[model samples]
Target: MFALYITHPQVRIDPDVAVPKWGLSDIGSARARLAAESAWAGQLRRIISSNEVKAIETANILASASGVPVEIVEGMHENDRSATGFLPPPEFEMAADWFFAHPHDSFRGWERAIDAQTRIVSKVEAILAEHDPQAPIAFIGHGGVGTLLKCHIAGRPIARQGDQPAGGGNLFCFDLANRAISCDWTPMESWKGESRKG
Candidate 1:
């Protein structure tokens, strides 16, 4: 009854390409492979992912290693920033801070942080409600919404403090039965802990 919410790893950042279409970099793939080799990977019975390419790629690597079929869940995407299009990293950081700091307000017409959190929580709950609670599941997604989900599960207020560290390829675990977080965000490949193995 354990569930891991995992964010995809580093991606090929190209200014010309659509952000969602960008796949993992070589280092990202290698990191995912290493994480898949962990003993924890063997315990996963279900794998779900966002429709984004990077998340799907990460899910595929994990599914291949675990022999679990990857299922795409439609509503599990990154927060909708399409309204403002892509911003450079520095600008992105500023926008993200605004997103979390002002949960009720939309920054530059993007999805309101509160709204995104609600959607993610609703979708995740619906998915869990339909699945076998006795089975352990993994959900692969992007950092933005992943942090939002983490905050909900952790009973934390919307804040950047709840977000993952700078890089990607991170995860946190919670109990499927009660939705209580057992572990906070940590590196997917290197963290060794009770929750990590579940």
Candidate 2:
């Protein structure tokens, strides 16, 4: 069987509030709706989401459609950029580049990419350890850590190439039994939920 790893869609950018508290924009909600109605969405037996509002909202949308409950999973948040606060897109992109380029080093007090990767890997592995792999599942989270998890499962080095395309709301899939990534990031609305023989 395969499990989906989904990144929350576009958020209502609020320069005034903490980033994690940001919720989905109208467009994001619509996209989430489309994804929820996707044929593959019905295959999901459970949804696990990061505690961030955006992720939870996305998971809730999908969960409602799948007739499953959304389970909040702590420690699955985006890389800690709260230390530096919000940066304009250009500056933020540059910092993100540095963050990936130097996975072992902190960029301006932000969490080291390697550390974040380790944390995500540990938490996901723990989840897998406890879950029954007979059914498919989805993990709703942020792009940074989702990419980190992708890279780890693919046995690739930490790099931005694994990151989702601009605008978020994307997903990847991996085999639940063997922990091998089977797909790269695809927009949630467009993905067909490719089948896995497992």
Candidate 3:
């Protein structure tokens, strides 16, 4: 019995904005559609996503293609970085680095990496427990939290942190039972190739 953890790439919202809810960009939606058609077309028994808008948007596309309803899981959301949400990218990176250096105190306005990991892992474990052991599930989530969740599952201490995925770009799959990883990182150029205009 294994569950598949998949992330929505190119869904990064503007860190300097008060983005309470923003849908995925054009590339993000395309990646999700391709992901459904590629790795998880008929294999997934269920589709789940973080409660955030970008995640939901991505999940909806996957679910539509796969003929599964998207279930929202609030527990699997990205770390709460609402406190310093308006910082520019460079400042945000510095602050995030400081947060990794001080996890215990990282949740003043944002959730600590350790806390976020705990919540996400526990919820995922619970989902596994609730579902049929042999049924496979797919999850859509944000990049920063999704990558950290992988780090936690892999038992690697995150030396540097915040949304930086290793080699995989962002779209990935973690086999819960066998601990295998398969990443379908759509290259930035490839994403640009698929970009659509309104």
Model 2 regions lying over 4 Å from their true place? none
* Candidate 3 backbone collisions, by pair: 144-163
Best prediction by TM-score: 2
Predicted candidate 3 versus true structure: per-residue lDDT over 125-174, tens digit per residue: 78876776566677777666675667766677754643445322254444
Global CA lDDT computed for model 2: 0.92
> Cα deviation in Å at residue 191, candidate 1?
3.2
Better of 1 and 3 by TM-score: 1
Best by lDDT: 2
Q: Count backbone overlaps in model 2.
A: 0
Candidate 1, residue 91: the lDDT equals: 98
Instruction: Report the lDDT tens digits of candidate 1 across residue range 62-123.
Output: 88767989999898999988887779999999999999999999999999989999988998
lDDT of 2 at 142: 91
Per-model TM values vs. the true structure:
0.95, 0.97, 0.78
Ranking by TM-score: 2, 1, 3
